[model samples]
Every structure is written in structure tokens, then in C-alpha cells.
Target: MDTTTWTLEQVKDRISKGQEIDERVVDIGQNTVVKFADNVSAEEGEATMFIARMTSVPVARIYAILRDESDGVTYIVQEKLRGEPLINHLPTLDTATRDALALELQKILNELATLDKGHMGLFGRPSQYGSGILAKFDPPVPPIESPEDFLRWLPHNVRDNYGRDEAPLPTGIFDFSRPPIFSHGDFVPENILIEDGHVTGIIDWAYAGWYPYFWNDYIARRRSTLMAFQDGKWSQMVGQMMQPFPEEFRAFQQLYYRADSLL
Candidate 1:
């Protein structure tokens, strides 16, 4: 909260001087700017701050937090861990490692679900989510500036070389038919912290909310779990519980839509 734009080194100095950067200390995606600060002097992304306030509990208890306050916005900051996101484990971790991490994550998720129910959507919490992905993908905002261009890109982007060919997959975006519960709006390996075959922490609560069970389902069952989703047991359960949707969406949407990591 100073009058001039501060470099990362200068801001660190202010934080050290107790200038109110808060307890947040994560420097996520330091190499990239995930958002643009509007305060005329602030940096971008600030996922750190977004994660701090979203959860009712302290980050240390279960996860680290980050806060984005320079732009008059307040949120959590989480330090990036050493290992690759949990997604990396899918390709390499042994059974014990995978199970251990999954259970740990499941445990933490269950704890989150117990928080107050009513305030559980993006509207309820001004979490810095889509902003993060936007910052990461930097998708052309304003809907691609020209509708025609987006339409032009769509066909070639897929070119029949995309989506699932499987006949029966869960369809459409997730609906909130199920009761509201705590949810990691975008729970994926990338946002998780893993160490030595177990989940060390959860990060990026920007999408935390009380939403449809299937949304969480979609994320947990995503590309990272392509093997698991296709597993006979998991597939059969999906068929029993989910409604049908488009085949093209499997790669694009089904990954997260199928996972309901409710607990």
C-alpha cells in the first residue's frame, strides 16, 4: 500500500517492515504474471491472496495460502512446493504412493465440505479463479474480440483429432442438483502439493465453493485419472450416477465434470 510501484525486491522489503502483506508467503508462478493489477502500481495474478480468504480454516493446518492485496484485493498466498503437481504422480508413482496421496487429499476435502453451506459459489466468494486460469492461458478476454475468429479457430483446433470416442460418457457441464458442500472448484494435480508419495498440501482455493457434486467429480476424475476413470469399477459407477453428454467433450470437459471429490 505505498504511493509508487514497487519491484518484487522492494515489496519484499515492505513486507519485511511489517507493511501488511499478511501471513501469505507463496510466490506462485513467479516466472509468469497471472493477472493484471488495476491499482495503477500493482503486479498481476495474485493467486496467493485469492487462496488465503476462501477457506474458513488456516492454510497451515491443511494447506498454504496466498493473498493478492496490492490491487485493493485480499486473498491467500501459497509457496510452490518442490515436486511437480500431483498429476506428475499419475505417470510414475507406485500404488502405495498414489493411494496415500489420494486418501490424504480426500481427507482434507472432507474437512472443507463441513464449512457453512450457503456461501459456496463463485458469486458468494470473489475468489481470484477464472482470473488465474486467464492469467495462465491469458485467453483473449472480451470473448476473443471478434466472435468470428473464435468460430474459425474451433474447427481446426479439434479437426476431428479431439475428444473421446467412447460411446457413454458423462455429459454437459456439471449441474448443482446435489446438495451444496465445500468444493475445490478446480481440484487438479497442478494445484496440489505432493511429497514422498503423499499429499503435502492443497493449494489454489480460488474456485473453492459449495457447488454441484459433479463439478468436484469432474476435476478429480480428470485427465490425471484417465486410467482410473476408465477402470471398470469407476466407469460402472459413473454410468450409474451420471447423465449423458457429448463425446467431443470428454477431453475438453469430462475430465473435471465427472469427478465429484465431495469429501
Candidate 2:
């Protein structure tokens, strides 16, 4: 269905009667899905368009982003890619296919990194949208001036409980000299789509942003820990897809553990 002409009210009414795909997403049709949120950010839709226009990386196309005036709900209409989440394909994937997928992921990650380091926040928006170890903010954190400022804003326990003086892993562990790069922000198996051993789509851009160069690698490794059923090999596969940052991963692990209670 061509949802290009969909209005907010029309989309809202359709969604009211659409089949729920999940809590926030609805299957308006085989070709379309809509995500609604009371506190929606334009970041996801903008990032989806940005990726489609700027790179060859496959992403779900956004048809419309509408906000209701009567109430504060926002709607994002997007293409529903014809593929299952990569997570579902893991159990059946052969060694050769897994390697091919890794190579594809590497190519995609390299393409995304080529995007200019505009600022340390959401694509086209300076405000931070937390991912990885940081908790999502209600009113997102304002544009950060420096990496140090970003670190300072992290939970005290997350930043300080590592050692003496409650210092973070190491002063220079995060090289602020390196500029932030465009990232998917979340690169777990669930966000990736695979069809016939080929990656068809990369969805969920809520955390997509310009982040520290190592952010993607770090987050992937950290997230793999939660996929206990993946046989603890997800991180290894993630390392194959991109350069692994052992030191950064170690540091983030400590931060993640300290902030685990709060999460």
C-alpha cells in the first residue's frame, strides 16, 4: 500500500484497527508497519532516511512521520522488509554463511563510519539518546560539548566505582581525540534481518547516532552477553564483523555491571 498519502488521523485510525506486531509496532499491512509513541523522537525516522540516502546499507524506508495534535502521540510509518531477524537464522546458519554475513556486516559498518562526524548525538539532532550501558533519558541529554562532558553525565557509580578516587577504567581509555562516527548505535542480531543467508535489512534506529568511533563495537560485545541462548558465541561473531576493542569492552563491562542494578 502506498502510505505516502497517509495523514496522521488516518494512520492513527488504521493503527487502532491494525494487528499489533508488538507493544509499539503494528502491522498495517504486509508491506507496511507503524510505530507509535507518546514520547517519539524524530531521530529514528530521520536516521532511516539518512542511511537510505547516504549509503547502500539496506534499511526500512520511512513513509511518513506524523504527530497527533489532539494527544501527544507520534507515528512512524515504515516499509516492512521481507525477512526474519538474524537471531532466528543463527541456529541454522552454516560456517560459510556466517562468514559471508560477517563480511557483509563489515562492509555496512565501514560505509556507516564514512558518514561525517557531525556531533556526538542522534543523527541530525544534537541531544543524546542513551544506549548500551546508559539509561534512556526522558528529556534527552542536551548536546554535549566534549567527550569528558559525556562521561561526567554518566551515572556516578558507572563512571566512578572502578578504582581509587572512584576513577573510570583509565583516563585515556577513551581517546577523545578521535572524532565521533555515525553508528547504528544498536547492532545486535535482533535488529538485523536475514533472508536466504543474506542480510536484507537493519531496523530499529532509535539509538542511531554519531558516537565515539569504538561505540558500535563496544555495544555489540556488551549486548551479546544478554543473548545467553546464543551459546556465548555471539560476541565472537560480532568481533569477526568489526574490529574488536578489547580494552574498551573491558571498561564498558565494568560500567555495565555497576549500572546493572539501576537498570
Candidate 3:
């Protein structure tokens, strides 16, 4: 039997079995080739997609499909690119295209800033802390019990960087804690798509959640923290660019960190 080709009858049977196949060839935007023959859904890269759906961000589009389907639930999809990925195409882009891409991304972030709170749904499934609130923020910390101990146990990083001495608090000692916004918790370039000079898609929502907006930056720095960005990994570069977002997005990322109680 040819795995690459399937009859519609075979596909219908497979789908009726609570699954789908690579029954048809689907070329998205421009470059992505999707094959659904055996009742399977869209498969991208080495991952198989199922139960995928698409939504729109203010400036970016979202696509998510289940990456795995063992739970009787498939992963989500929010990405579809028309042209080649930045990694495959970056070296060839003219400065104008590069700048245009960056500026367009910035505009998208700006639109995200004004989003309705309901947009937080973009995060998909929540692990705890009620989705965007982040369970980490509410994690139990051993009591300092006394001012002296409180001074002693303060995280060196927080003390050195976030201390009030260098800068006045943005609000109450906790006022920096703003409400969560819709965040592409796992912001990265692979999850983003650019066609011509404009961003066409924001894919991958498995890690989507209401995080302190700063998470985009934090996720971008995964290389430094996880040692995953060695040897010019494209993922690392994508995460790095996530840092230059405007201040409002910076604020959003900050909340994401706080969601992890890192702040």
C-alpha cells in the first residue's frame, strides 16, 4: 500500500474511527505542504497535527493542532506560513525586508497590548494558578519570619536588580504586578511566519497562557538559561528578538516572569 497516497473511502473510514488521515495535499499561505490522507490532520515538520483550529491575533494569526493524539485529544495549531521560514530565507532578505518584518512585528505587539482580557484564551490549556495567573506566583515560600531573615534570604538576583535603591518602585512594592494579558507564552520565530515583508502567522499554542507579558523575552533567553542556544540555534535567535518588543509588551513579559514567581 502506498503510504503517500490514500483513497477518500479509506480516509473517511479512518476519520470515522475518531481520527483523520493525510487525505489531501494542503499548501498553506505558500510554502507549507499539508497532507491529510489517513484521516490525519495537518502535519508540519516532524510533528503530526490534529484537531487544529485557527484564530486571529490583533496583528498576528494563530493556528494550533494537537501534536499528539493519545489522549483522545489532539494538539492545537496556530501557525501557517506562506513562504519559507526565516531560517531558510533570512540570509537572502534585503535590509528593507528585514526592517519591514521587525516593524510589522512591533505593530502586532502594539495591537496585542490593547487586546480584550478575553484574549487570554490564546494560552489554551492552563496547568494551574487559573491559567494566566501562573501557579508559580502563588507557590509557598518559607516564611522569613523576621525582617532580619527577610533581608538575609532575598534572592541575590532580585535584590541586586530589582531593589528599590536603584529605581523607585513602579507601584506598590507589588504594584508592578499588573493583570495578565494574552501572551504567546512560547514566543519564538519558528512559531512565527513571515511572507513577503509582513508577519502572516503565529503558530504553536501548546504553551499559550496568561503570563506576565515579559515571558516572550524570558522564553527568548532559553538559550542562556537552558544552554539550548549553542552554535547559533535558530530558536535562540528568535527568542532573542522577542526581547526588543515595545515597553507595553515588556510589561506583559514582566508579568509572565512573575507568573513563574521569578520576579
Q: Of the candidates shown, which would achieve the greatest TM-score relative to the real structure?
A: 2
C-alpha TM-score for every candidate? 0.46, 0.86, 0.45
Question: lDDT: which candidate is best?
Answer: 2
Instruction: Give Cα distance to truth, residue 104, candidate 1, Å.
Output: 1.2
What lDDT would candidate 3 get against the real structure? Answer: 0.41
Which sequence of candidate numbers ranks them by TM-score, best first? 2, 1, 3
- Weakest ten-residue segment in model 3 by summed lDDT: 45-54
Q: 147-235, model 3: which lDDT tens digit per residue?
A: 22222233432445444222122222232335555455555555567777677665544455444444455555542344433444444
The stretch of ten residues in a row with the least summed lDDT in candidate 1 is 32-41
TM-score of 2: 0.86
- Which of 1 and 3 is ahead in TM-score? 1
Model 1 Cα lDDT, one tens digit per residue, 97-161: 66566566656666666666543234333222242222322222222212132222233223232
**Where is model 1 more than 4 Å wrong at Cα?**
1-9, 12-83, 123-177, 224-263
lDDT of each: 0.40, 0.77, 0.41
Model 3 regions more than 4 Å off: 1-81, 118-175, 223-263
lDDT (0-100) at residue 7 of candidate 3? 38
lDDT measured at residue 206 in model 1 versus the true structure, 0 to 100: 51
| Tens digits of lDDT, candidate 2, 80-119 | 9889988887767888998889899999999998987677
